[model samples]
Target: MKYRFPEGFWWGSASSAAQSEGAAQQGGKAKTIWDHWFEIEPNRFHNQIGPAQTSTFYENYRQDIQLMKNIGHNSFRTSISWARLMPDGINVNQEAVTFYNNVIDALIENGITPFIGLFHFDMPLYWQQKGGWESRETVEAYAKYAEICFNLFGDRVACWMTFNEPVVVVEGGYLYDFHYPNKFGFRMAAQVAFHMMLAHSLAVRCYRSLKLPGRIGIVLNLTPSYPRSQHPADLKASFIADLFFNRAFLDPAVKGAYPAELVSLLKEHDQLPVYQAEDLALIADGKVDLLGINYYQPRRVKARMTAISPDAPFMPDWFFENYEMPGRKMNPYRGWEIYEKGIYDILINLRDHYGNIDCYISENGMGVENEERFIADDGQVKDDYRIDFIREHLKWMHKAIQEGAHCRGYHLWTFIDNWSWMNAYNNRYGFISLDLETQVRTVKKSGEWFAEVSRNNGF
Candidate 1:
């Protein structure tokens, strides 16, 4: 059987500035929270490696872009490090500007479209000290920074994303304490989540106000919440999970409003964040022109069997519990469940309930620890497992597209194995493998397969 995508389907991979571009201190790049976190507690990162120890994309972008071309990438997504572009999130760094201009130009020169993301969890440390996303001041400052990006690089970059996975910032930073400014308070989490949405909306407004030529959108890692069983309680649990995790940002970005039930629940719990009266209107006016959906896994949940004590702190988990279904397939390396059908479910939900907005799979890839174990005798990773993972998901994506889902393209998580946040290079999820010691890149089996897929526009 043969499967083909649309005429101009974007076939590429995604990367981030902080993760790929080393030279943390060079290029006039100020310290991001990742850099600061490593400075304060070096051991927190994997193998004591930090943001400074990246794939050195800053100095080697031209070579990397050539690799992208060799891999048949027509479009690629990478973030502009807020700290790198504006050292203090205010002053423009000319060195950083020159570096980025070269990067964008190289992508264009190679016949690849540049999909530039404004933020990717690398908040400037100076902004963190000023209360991070929790402060309205930081939100306003981010709006200004976003406008600066539009004026600087809007001419070359056609596809713009306001933020990549805003939910990760809320869950990792405020809930799980995995990212920087780690805090574990329900109210504070809600406040940070609200303010991040406000910042995204403000950036969207700024993009529109500039009348930019290209499409502007937000990238959300939507983990479709699945209930354990057909029981009403389990169904209710799934509903709440989706509302909190998916709709928290999806609603405003696409539907131009917050989910009313979610708002009511927050108000009832006195967990609403501080916001100006006009903020809702701004959010309404800032609906996205496109959506980037990053689906790596689905959230399988069930109604909580145990009731929490009244004195217990409020958390989204209070309403449900993770239900590990029997015999569920799992990615042993990354510990994420392998649910390929979740991609189709997500697209169908968007099509049926959310107006079938224009979207694309922004990030989807398997991360494996100690991937060197899979290296072949020919000096390439025989990543057949990753190839299978992508193929299965793409099959479902193709089905959804055939069923009238407005999905545009599919981009894997990354082009090269770069530095992951605190998990710094531990879980490699790229078509091209990066050699840390030599800073050499090798195209893996998956890369060869992806090139063919891009060339044929399908399988």
Candidate 2:
């Protein structure tokens, strides 16, 4: 193989509880924010589809684990639903425990390492009603919940994550109004962001207190910001965007401190979050043992063209704007820019700027609409586009690793077509495509191709 990885390189894909597990109200699981939001605003979801409809991983994990083995997955990641494990976000749910235990044991029996995430944006309806991440009580509840998980299943899990793409949670819930409890404000966003990090630190503390056998970390969707021009304004805009979006969580996750510039910028705007002095001490405890990068696209940034009125709401956009570079590559199906080198830049940045921390490509995949349109006579998707996408990204990743990057693995965004948040199933992102109407699974060309890459440790 020309582009080979290190010995024992982990090859698998990631999944989230709310996105893949379809037994929403079954097996003694309660409602999450996704369920509640779907109930109230069904139209917000595509075709009125919601959390109750998924790939049915909850009912089919054994078969999915066999599929993982068939596709050469040595490691796989999927999160536990907080709403399922702790219906009230405090007490334990034994039925959920047995179900998760069976899933974990099944993956082990299939020779696939289990990477368990404690939270994956599936805030329990119980917690959301308590002000979600806004309330410090929610943070404490989350920490306690983390302790319960560690006590129950830490024995078999190899990796644990506190949260995933926390910036999205901050952006969607507070700044942009894309998620449940959607609001628009920077002050509350700041508070929620801080509390989330604090909550992460608390979870890390709990994991350490028990001295679990595995590593603990968080998965961040790191979007490398590229400036539109060499102009100083454009450069500054890129820096600020990175500060607010990337470093907001990355810095505190790996570095143990929020960027001084970030704090000063928030202070200048009177947007500092309400945090106790001891919170910093706790935040220091939350530094991760591993970092997971979810890179799908790069953020193209430019200086703001127009000034914001003094009466207007303060937001991240107050400092910068996003634009598409003319002639840049695009993923038309998902409407996202495709710059394969962005993965290289992200890995290089981590190597040079973030102490070469141990990390992995936790998610990098292409989502396409109506993938069935490419079905071959063999009754499988001839997704050559997706295969090329993976190869291009992997070439850059291989280059990064050759340059002494501490990247250990690459896991695709998903293993199978599953329900997405607001987009529902509009865009399919999986090596194995699913027919939701029939729950039929068909391995795509990319799946077979990836199996070869894994068996050979390269392309």
Candidate 3:
């Protein structure tokens, strides 16, 4: 059966600079936190392999894009390494420009549209020394960097994302230990998030200033918060969680202001992020042309009556606790629940509340353990589960479109199996498999299925 997408639907996959591009030290790429951290704590990374030894996309992007075309990608999303382009967030490198230009031209020549992101959690070590995103100077530096990229690659790259999952950069790296600069401080995380939003707004302003032809957007990982029960406390808890995690950024980036509840909560706790009056105006006026939604799972919340911190400093722990509901479908390999309807809910919310902004599923896929187990004797991977994972999500996404949502496309989390942050290479989330030792790329079963979907515009 052939299920066709709407006219001009985009088909592609997504990858990050740090995850796919090796040769980290060669292209005038100053060390990022990952590069520095790997040198110090090799054991922290999976199999002790650092980001320097990725799929080597930096050298093989030409062949890689051809592989993308072979597997069926009319569009592809990838990020520029901040350090690669600027080295120290201050000095621009000509060699890096030449490299990316070649890559952009190659992808375009093969009829693959490039969706480029300005930053993807890889802060240059120099910037990290300067307090990373927590410093306002870093925010300005990012704006300048974005301007450079806009001028350099904007002609061919139609889609520009200001930042990929800024919240994850703050939460995962600052509050959790899953990423570089692993410091568990909510205060610092809040500061970093505020600066990140500022950086995003500044970048959008730069893109607008350039009068670039393509649309500019920001990619956010939006996890819908669900209450575990009908109890008022639980409902309130969920509301607070949503305000903090979802609406804090969503309202500003989409609706052009921070959520009132979030402001009130922060004020009540004396944790309100410092902001200049002009910052509000800039954010309000510098709204994105589109939105990139990365939906992995929904958050289930229940009220927490007791104050969370005993001796620790301020945090948002007074709000709620995550509750894993019974009978939820689980992805054993990734530890995330499968909830296809969440996609429909996200689309519906965008239509009703967020003005139905032009958007796409920027990243969505199933990550499996030991995916090599599925490699067949025919040199193909039998990844039927991945096909199912994507199909289920697309089924809901298509339904949302029928109901008047403005979803433009769907790009899976990755094209080739590559290294992930912290998880390293443990979880495979690609339509194609990669042999790390030989740097060999083989198309998986899902890759063939995706080809047909792209050829037909849908499943």
Candidate 4:
């Protein structure tokens, strides 16, 4: 193995409850925001497909765990559906508890470590009705819910995450129109972002209060921002973009604070979110024990040449302009740039700037549209492109590790081709491909190769 990883490197994949668990309306589970959104505006989803029907992890988890073992996975990550566990976001659901326990027990039985995440953007409709993350009440409820999960499952689950890609919740739901309850405004975005962080701190406090046997953290999708040129203006633009996207959450999670520059900029624009006097101390308590980074692309920025009118809505873009670099590598299947070295850049940045924190690649994989077109004989998907994608990214990541970055593991975006929100399986990203119609799972060529990589501890 030319690119061998350190001993005990974790190789696995991630999926969320909302994306993989098909019993969206069954098992005493109440409606989630995704379920309700699909119900009213089914047309908004691809192929008019919604979360009501999924890869059926709820029913097929046992078989799936066996498959994971066969494919040489030593760890796996998935979220518990808050909506399923607490239909009204207050009381416990015993049936859902039984289901989750079975899933966790089965994973251990098969020699796979379980990484449980509490929230993954699947807000219970009951909570959404009460203003979701925007309301302080939801923040308090979330902490209570975290405490319940800890008392119930924290003994066996040694790894936990408070939320996955929380900034996406703020950007997608409040700043942009891509998500449900979409309203475009910076004030709402800032407020929601603050409340979610507060909720994370409270949950961290709850976990510490119980002294659970696990380490809890948050998963962030960290895209490294690069200036198009070395010019000071372009550099400043890139710095601001980084502040808004990466450091906004990273600082609080790792350092128990926000960047001073970000605070000054927000203050200059009179866009500070309303926070309690004690919120600062609480946020300082939210520092994580581990960090999960999801890296897929890089953001290239340039100085803003045009001025924003005073009446224009304040957005992160107002301070910088996105610059599309010519001749950049791209993944045409999913319309995302393919920059393998960006992984190294991110790891090195963490090593140099963030105290070399313990971290791992939680979600990194290629998604291909119409992947059935690549099927080969012997009933397997001939996904060489996916193989090359993983190998190149791993190569860069290996270099970072060699340079003293504290990266611990790498997990693909998914285990099976689960339903992606809104995109709904349009782009398949899994070592095991799924037959949506018949619910069959077949290991792709990359899966065989990955099993070998796991067995060898690298490629």
User: Relative to the true structure, how large is the alpha-carbon lDDT of every model?
Assistant: 0.92, 0.93, 0.89, 0.93
lDDT tens readout by residue for model 4, 317-413: 9989989899999999788899999999999999999899999999999999998888977888999999999999999999999999999899999
Q: How does candidate 2 score on lDDT?
A: 0.93
What digit string (tens of lDDT, one per residue) describes model 1 on residues 1-459? 889999999999999988999999987888999999999999889899999959999888999999999999999999999998888667899998898899999999999999999999999999999999889999999999999999999989989999999999999999988988888987899889888888888888888888879999999999999999999999999999999999999999999899999999989999888888998998897799899999998899999999999999888998899999899999987899999999999999999999999999999999999889989789999999999999999999999999999999999989999888888888999999998889889999999999999999999
Q: Model 2 compared with the native: what TM-score?
A: 0.99
Model 2 residue-pair collision total: 0
Clashing pairs in 4: none
Off by more than 4 A, model 4: none
> TM-score: which is higher, 3 or 4?
4
What is the C-alpha lDDT profile of model 2 across 327-431, one tens digit per residue?
A: 999999888999999999999999999899999999999999999899999999999999899999999999999999999999998899989999999999998
Candidate 3 per-residue lDDT, tens place, 225-324, comes to 9999999999998888888788878888998788887888788878876788888888786588899999999999899856666677766666798899
Query: What is the Cα-based lDDT of residue 300 in candidate 2?
Result: 97
Candidate 2 clashing pairs, residues 3+ apart or interchain: none
